[model samples]
Target: MLDDTLKSQLKAYLEKVTQPFEIVASLDDGAKSQELHGLLTDIASLSDKISLNLYGQDSRRPSFALNRPDQDMGIVFAGIPMGHEFTSLVLALLQVGGHPPKVTDEVIEQIKGLDDALHFETYYSLSCQNCPDVVQALNLMAVLNPNVSHVAIDGALFQDEVEERQVMSVPSIYLNGQLFDQGRMSLEQILAKVDTGAARREAAKLNDKPSFDVLVVGGGPAGASAAIYAARKGIRTGVAAERFGGQVMDTMAIENFISVPHTEGPKMAAALEEHVKEYEVDIMNLQRAVKLVPATQPGGEHEVQLESGASLKSKTLILATGARWREMNVPGEADYRNKGVAYCPHCDGPLFKGKRVAVIGGGNSGVEAAIDLAGIVGRVTLIEFMDEMRADAVLQKKLKSLPNVDIILGARTTEVNGDGTRVNGLTFEERASGEIKRLDLEGIFVQIGLIPNTEWLRGSLVEMSERGEIITDAHGTTSVPGIFAAGDVTTVPYKQIIIAMGEGSKAALGAFDHLIRS
Candidate 1:
């Protein structure tokens, strides 16, 4: 199941194992069972301390009982740990064998204080990169306390259970038979939900109306940068974001941030929040701005109303609401969102490496994705609705130079075809001949244009472009005297991380200048 190189690496990791651990694998008479059995056998052979036991599947099909003797650990895997979740398996084995959990003392205390029984059923897919983190965190939590038992379910293997639970996405977590969390979640976030009373208390404290000198909306790279800059000026800066990471959290590998050679989206997003936390910036996460009220006069304060019924007033305002990727909205697109049809090439492309994939859209992002995928994947098919490509000459040339890439023009994607579990292929119609065509591919990356998140500014004093993007001049000053805008939600020429960060800094300086003048 694993290559020689991987075996060698795993051997080194297993060599450090000090405590004894056994992997009890229970498999049924299924095709995937054989594959999983072989994988577990290979892993068990890597270390002397590790042992593998095979058993017939019971009510819990394809289950794994880790450390059979120490059943009190309450650690179990109800799915084959492969793909991105392989790391979770490796870490679990080590943790069960006496390796301490990576969680902080505060988190440990929170887990220890839990009196009620917490049973977590986390559904995940092998290809989902974000799923492993949540799975590992829950596994670690289970190891920390016997009351907290977790069953990591592979959504692919347990399709019936997935359908019964209406699990539309990966990392769908259920606590005590109720949906607990979804998508990428931090350990602290999970703990917050464990104690609902404490979570409500914390939310109430944050909901208390807070005022600031410079209030930045959205918590993407731009908003975080703006908050940092404003806070550095010794002002009461605050950031209101539905999620701190914004679109950046959806991104995968980022290479064009200037100094940094390579980093993932979640990593950079965490860094942004951590850097902002270094300052005195008041970060109000999970808070959405429903409406913006501009200052009546030059020296008056602008008010921002949140969906949580809380209000934030500031002398100067920075709008870095960011943008979201436009979806194709075709049949089966939403159903197989994380199953195979993905949007961010940077985040999910590597998962389809060496597999045949398709890229929809002829713009810069689509062309760039095709070029990027051509190197990693076996083949890339670029389909464009228009007759001619709309990408820049340089990017078009680079895309054309890829030998493993094929470009198709005047093709309208009809539907995303999947086989219940994941995407299998796609269908399209020729715009000229009306002939239907199909391509067998594992992944489809949609890199269409981004929709700016400036809809909330409608009817407000802020001037916007025809496309709903905020129109701002140099120094990030908008049409409004005290209000400023930046990032993808603005009419900025380029929507990039570094560019947005620079724009945020400029907007903060512009706010400082306006505060001094008035």
Candidate 2:
């Protein structure tokens, strides 16, 4: 299963294992089971502390569990962890073998202190860029607490389970036989959900923090850049965000991030955070900003309030809050979201494999999603309200070459129709005529655009565009003297990662200039 170079790396990683463990696999007489056996054998060959047991009593075939020799607590992977989850496999091996996780010690202690037993099952797709994080986090939790157990299942490989559970999206998690969540979630986010008092504790901690010279709201590319620039000026810099990566974390392939030929969103987001950490920026993740109060006078402190009932004051405030996927807002769309209506084709495309699906929009994202889904789903229907596709000419040409794809222009999506549990089809209206049509499909992918994260700043003194995006001058300075805005949350012409970073840097400089003059 693993190549020669991969084997060398695995051997080196296994060398760090200080404890003995076993790979207990439950298999049947099938091709997939044979492949899994070969993989386990290859991994067991890397270190003397690791042993492989091919026979097990578990009913789930092609599944393996990693456990310590002295402990009954272990984590299970029901499907082969390849592609994006290969990192997860490596981390499980090391973590279950008594190696420390990359999370903070406080979080580690919190996981270990949990007394309630949790049986978690995660259904994920190999192509999903967001699945590895959730899977790995749960695996680490299982390693930390014996009361916590998790099984990571591949949705594509286990079609029966996916259908029985009505899973229409990747990274669907079930806890104690009930649906816990769907979509990407961090360790802290999961903990906050499970631990009832975590929010109050976090709020108390945040409330005790001192004021900062430059405080950045949001933690996307722009926020990271602004925080770094501010910290470099020997000013106290802090960053509060709902989650450090913003919408970029949900993005798939990013090809235009200069210098680097190609990269994924999660990888780039991690790199951005790491680069910012090289400075003196104090990052507070999982904190959502709900309100922003402008400074009373020049060089005075502005307050940013969080949803956790905590607020922080800053001398100069930089609002780099990014945007989110624009929803259709049609009837039943919200009710069926994650049940069948998904925004990320890269994450949820595999769930609709061998089934019909529709992509709503004519822009580059929509065309690209159709192109990617053509190879996975049985049929791809691209519905657009416009007369022509807004995608690049090259993308449109390539989309036209796909045999499984059907393009319908001048059609607007109307409603998402679903059976009680999952979506079955949707209705659309013809632009030229008053006729309404329906598409019999299992999934709908929305790729229209984004809505800025500036709704929280409504009625504030800051200038803003009609779209709710903060308006700023060339210096990235908002109408308010001590307040600046950048990134997708602002009225920037181009909403790209590089552009956001440049704007953030400019805003930091502008804030400093104002600070000195005041």
Looking at model 1, residue 146 earns an lDDT score of 80
TM-score of each: 0.74, 0.99
For model 1, the superposed segments whose C-alpha errors exceed 4 Å read 1-71, 78-118, 125-127, 140-147, 153-169, 174-182, 187-203, 329-358, 364-381, 390-407, 413-445
User: How would you encode candidate 1's per-residue C-alpha lDDT over 330-350 as one tens digit per residue?
Assistant: 898998887778776654555
Highest TM-score model number: 2
Clashing pairs in 2: none
Q: Which stretches of candidate 2 lie over 4 Å from their true place?
A: none
Alpha-carbon RMSD to native, per candidate: 5.5, 1.0
Task: Output candidate 1 Cα RMSD.
Answer: 5.5
lDDT of 1 at 419: 93
